[model samples]
Target: MKDIAIVAYQQSDGVSDAGAVNEVELIMPVLDRTFEQARLDSAQDVDFVCSGSCDYLQGAAFAFVAGVDALGAVPPIKESHVEMDAAWALYESILKIRMGHADSALIYGFGKSSPGELPIVLSQQLDPYYLAPQWVDSISLAAMQARLMLDQGLITERDMAEVVSRSRRNARSNPHAQLAGDVSPEDVLAQETYLSPLRKADCCPVSDGASAVVIATVEKAKEWGLPYAIISGIDHRIETHNLGMRDLTDSVSTRTAAEHAGMHDGKVDVAELYAPFSHQEIILTRALGLGEETSINPSGGVLAGNLMMASGLSRIGEVFNRIVSGEAQRGVAHTTSGPCLQHNLVTVLEKA
Candidate 1:
């Protein structure tokens, strides 16, 4: 693969509800900031443009076409869209660059999941005959996964609460985070359970937001004279759909994806994992073999605020932020989709 570098990343504030903020409005400011940072005038300046969003969130088909309004329609631009998280959209853009189709690309993802029952809406994405028909919400599926972990002595309730506590505390430094404060494990355990074996604190709060990233070849970055981070390696993997067949306690898919992404090539100074649920963070951390040497979710991750389609991209963006700011020499970012982390993507970033 051709060496590529991320030039810029920007995101909107994570809020529980965006109220009357239309999709275009929510995305415009983020695009402007990203463009400014990348020294580009508009999406037209990039060789290709791709977005990540879900039509289901708006209850209409081809809803992402409206996002074009934010991108400017008069000038023709090469563009595409993906139904999955924007992190996957970044994956697509990376392939486009490596294939020599383009030297630079703009990628973005947006979501407004507060308008409907997010859990129920996501349930439709599950196996139609076996799971979707039953209308099992996302929380319930995760709760079952948590139960399996608990039954096997993999983690304790206190362990889960500790994850939440760290997330909340870590989010304090994130200006865009929705849930950030000092809360201890005892405080988390005191809260009543929203679902069996899973407290509300253990779940990510629904959020409406958008995030954008710009990438180019290393030569392009040097020509632009902007500090950047190199994308060392990336890979994605998925497990069997049948929940009963897989080991819920371990993230086999994450481990496989990490190995393929060259995560063990060197020391990982920081990691931004897209773990919507607290326990899943522990699962990913252990799966990646991260220790005290690595900082996990220093920006509080999705648990601070969950933007359905965009959080995955935000994870990668977070790592880029750390690297450019000199907080980390190399970092790993992880993203997930489906119930109980059924599908996973891992990305490795390094200082240039």
Candidate 2:
């Protein structure tokens, strides 16, 4: 496979609620900035475009189609859309780049969860016939996962609080994070629970956000003088859709994706993992074989603020940020979709 690299990335500041800004107004500038940072003109340098987003967020079908207009499609750019997160779309774009069908590509993901009841909408992602009717919200599902982890002795309630404290504390330095501050595991534990074992602090706040990345082949990266990070390997896998059919304490899909992406080959310099809940991060860290030496979610990660479809892509953009800023030579970013880690994607990146 041809080597593909992320050449540019940009993200909008995540907010608790992005008022009345339409998706186009919110994303157009980000798209423009990403292409500019890549040192490429959108209409000239880009060969294909792929996006990750969901219709449920907007309460309308084809919500992603309008976001595509942010690319200024009068010239008719090659494009596709995924009902999943933008990282999955990025994965598709990478496949195209590897095929020699395109040298450079752009990918974007957007989510605005503020206008309506966020959790209610996410419940629809479950099986329509069996799960949707139950209306199990995202936080409760995460709480279930947390309870299982607790039962397995993989983590404790105190550990969950610590994860929340650390993630939000790290967000203080991140200008784009929606939640950031210092709190104690004891303080978090003392808070009221939204669901037993899951407090408000443990749950990611609903957010409005968007993010994008520009990727190019090795030859094209040299041509544009773009800061590049090699796409060493990319892979994703799916697990049994029914939460009851699988072990809730661990993510098998994440393990498969990491192994397929060759994450265990050598020492990893850094990692950007997309885990909206603190427990999921623990599960992912174990599955990816990431230990104390590996820097995980230096960008504060999704627990600071999860804009649904945008969180996964934002993780990719975070690793690209590290590469371009000369922080490390090698890294990995992982993304997930569906309930309780039903789908997972992993990408290995290196600065050359």
Candidate 3:
């Protein structure tokens, strides 16, 4: 495979509701910033363009087609779309470069989740015959998983609260974060539970926003004359859909993906994990065998502000940013899809 480097990354400030901003409006500004970061002009500059989004969010078929308006494909461009998170779109772009079909590519993800019942809409992604018919919302499913962990003695409510407190504290420095500030575990524990074992503070807010990244081959990066982070390794794994069949307290798929991605090949300086819930962070940390030496979620992660489809890609961007900024020599970025961390992708990046 060809060595790939992420050259540019950009994201909008996450908001609770982008009231009047349509999907195209949410995507255009981020795209413009990404192009500028990469020292490019437009979609015409990249060999390929790919996006990640869900039509269910728009309640319309081919809703992602409307997002093309942001790209200004008037001259026509090579592009594609994925129903999954933008991290998967990044994977597709990597494959294109590896095949020598493209030298550089643009990837972005967007979501306006405030327009619909976000969790309920996500329920449709579950098994239609079993889980979907019962309308088991995402948060509720997470709560079930949390309860299982709690019962198994793997974690505690206090432990979960600490994760929330750290996320809010870490987010204080992040301009794009929707939730930030200092909050104690006691404070989070004091709040009433939104769903039995899960407090409102434990859940990621429903957010509307977008994120974009520009990646190219190492030779292409040298040609562009930009600071870049090499994607040393990347791999993804998924578990069985039946929630009962798998261990809810552990992230087996994450462990497998991390292993295959060469996460432990060298010392890890930082990690950006797409853990939407507080408890999930603990699970990922243990699964990856990350010790105190590694900084986790310096961007506050998804618990600060989840952009749905975009947050996954943002994980890779966050690690790349840290590496290029000299804060870390190497790092790992993780993205997840499906309920209860059923699917996971892991990418290891090093400074170029």
Candidate 3 accuracy as TM-score? 0.99
Candidate order by decreasing TM-score: 3, 1, 2
Per-residue alpha-carbon lDDT of candidate 1 for residues 8-60, written as tens digits (9 for 90 to 100): 99999999999998889989999999999999999988999899999988677
Per-residue lDDT of candidate 3, residues 25-55 (tens digit) = 9999999999999999999999999999988
List the pairs of residues colliding in candidate 3.
none
Cα lDDT computed for each candidate against the true fold: 0.94, 0.85, 0.94
List of clashing residue pairs for candidate 2? none
**lDDT (10s digit) by residue, model 2, range 48-97:** 89988888787777888789778878767889988889998888998888
Please give the clash total of every predicted structure, in order: 0, 0, 0
**Among all windows of ten consecutive residues in candidate 1, which has the lowest summed lDDT?**
72-81
Tell me which of candidates 1 and 3 scores higher on lDDT: 3
lDDT of 3 at 138: 97
Stretches > 4 Å off in candidate 2: none
